[model samples]
Target: MSAAFFSRDIVSLPPSSPGMRIGLFGGSFNPPHEGHRLVSRECLKRLDLDAVWWLVTPGNPLKDHSDLAPLDARVRAARALVAGPRCHITGFEAAHGFTYTFETLSHLQKTLPGRRFVWIMGADSLAGFHHWERWDEIFSMMPVAVYVRPGSTRKAAVSRAASRFRHGRIDESDARLLATLDPPAWVFLHGLMSTLSSSQLRSRK
Candidate 1:
């Protein structure tokens, strides 16, 4: 199961269908759980996407690499938990040797043409997103959906990125059209908040 789960011989990885409205949900996915599943489903439904790629990254620049489990272990756990056609778990970052979000997004844009990709993340991530490397470049590359998260609505709303791009925010009713819009566009989804946090889950261990 371990050998086949990752099969490190992979190069380039399989591409998604062209013109597919895909959501790029990038993360370490240190431990797969129901909350990640719930977020993907909600993003798919709200954005009217054809599929959601859970980009299981090799490592996160913002996180301590030593604190994370082995890449294959994390990917295997993700593969085990993610089911159905719309949800895809790909270790593209690890396979392609990409580490940062900007690098991955740039690669995807060049690799998959005609495919509309939207960056998806919880509100808490948004609140601190400005601190990320080339964070502004990320906004310029794709539309972002800041899903409502427990206790993060206010902080995210007033975040540096949100404030800088406040004018680019569109109504929730127009969420389905996010992929069609240009960069600097984003939407904050309210009332769809989830109570799950990866850190919270890890703490219980």
Candidate 2:
């Protein structure tokens, strides 16, 4: 099935006022789990964001798609997990046919000007962020919040993206100020931890 099948969910953009701080949390979310929720809640509280937009993608270009779930199903699953007016789940990537985070983020900033956008991700994704298209540009376009994940702290810390942007890393104590900071600013958050992962959940199925 195509993303068009869920026409009602192909959101143009979530409601927001000027100066609203929104966290752009993008992922395949093959099976949205507590781990995903943890990152969302952490970023929301720590970054003092007004909302967290979960950009459920069509598929991850860096991973095999043979096991990827249908776009509509994944979006539905995400909606069921993330609630409240502040947390939004969107399949716009599938609807707009965007396969790159850089493009999707750029589109959001262009269409929704005057909003503070921060890119949110788990440490695991940070470890391989360099493989993404124009990954460096993504850092240049918005502030970033990386939550520590099980067994990925060290790897993510020494990651190419982390090392390259080391000078821009801010202290976690100033996390609440992250949304207000300029591009290239990032902070590594700790405390919340979950062993749950989409891959492990998929394996059991």
Candidate 3:
């Protein structure tokens, strides 16, 4: 399917149950592509999540917003790319007025206490997470699952956040258990990496 399918008012989506174990992959999907789908699929297969939620952010705090497409447009693009019973594209934060990852996690945790939530991200983001607002609070709130993206594995391994929380890294085989672990736990997944990126896609456009 094309990338135009995700364009919808996320506020209209139904609420998720608290019994589910979900992975939240938030980003400014200016244009969703195969890379985003691949990483999410890998996260589901390896981490055993019930579903992967693509939280299309209004804008990423770390990146300039000048190039970002309209939030609804990006959401639609993401929905079109993500096709499966296990995947969901949402702009819930926009409806909830959550502008930061830490706040989003906090809101979800409080709203759905029974569901286990894991923060899914690529190595590149993990590497720079230390600079995120309330970065330490995120670590203390939920288990993080980091997937190795090409060219980012090495730098992420030695990143300040990784080094500081190195003790929490678990074996790849145990990655699925991350959702059950206490806050601050994480795992590094190694597998096929997609070379496509949003920046590269935008530049070509």
Index of the highest-lDDT prediction? 2
- Cα lDDT tens digits, model 1, 81-142, are 98788887777576666768999999889978889999998888999999988999999899
Candidate 1: stretches off by over 4 Å: 1-14
lDDT of 2 by residue, 54-167 (tens): 998888888999999988788889989888888999888877778899999999889888999999998998999999999999999999999999899999999999999999
Candidate with better lDDT, 1 vs 2: 2
What C-alpha lDDT does candidate 1 achieve relative to the native structure?
Answer: 0.83
- Local accuracy of candidate 3 as per-residue lDDT tens digits, 113-140: 8988999899999889899999888887
Instruction: Work out candidate 1's RMSD over C-alphas.
Output: 2.8
Alpha carbon lDDT at 40, candidate 1: 91
For lDDT, candidate 2 versus 3, the one ahead is: 2
Badly placed stretches (over 4 Å) of model 3 are: 1-8, 12-14
Worst 10-residue lDDT window for candidate 2 reads 3-12
TM-score of each: 0.91, 0.96, 0.93
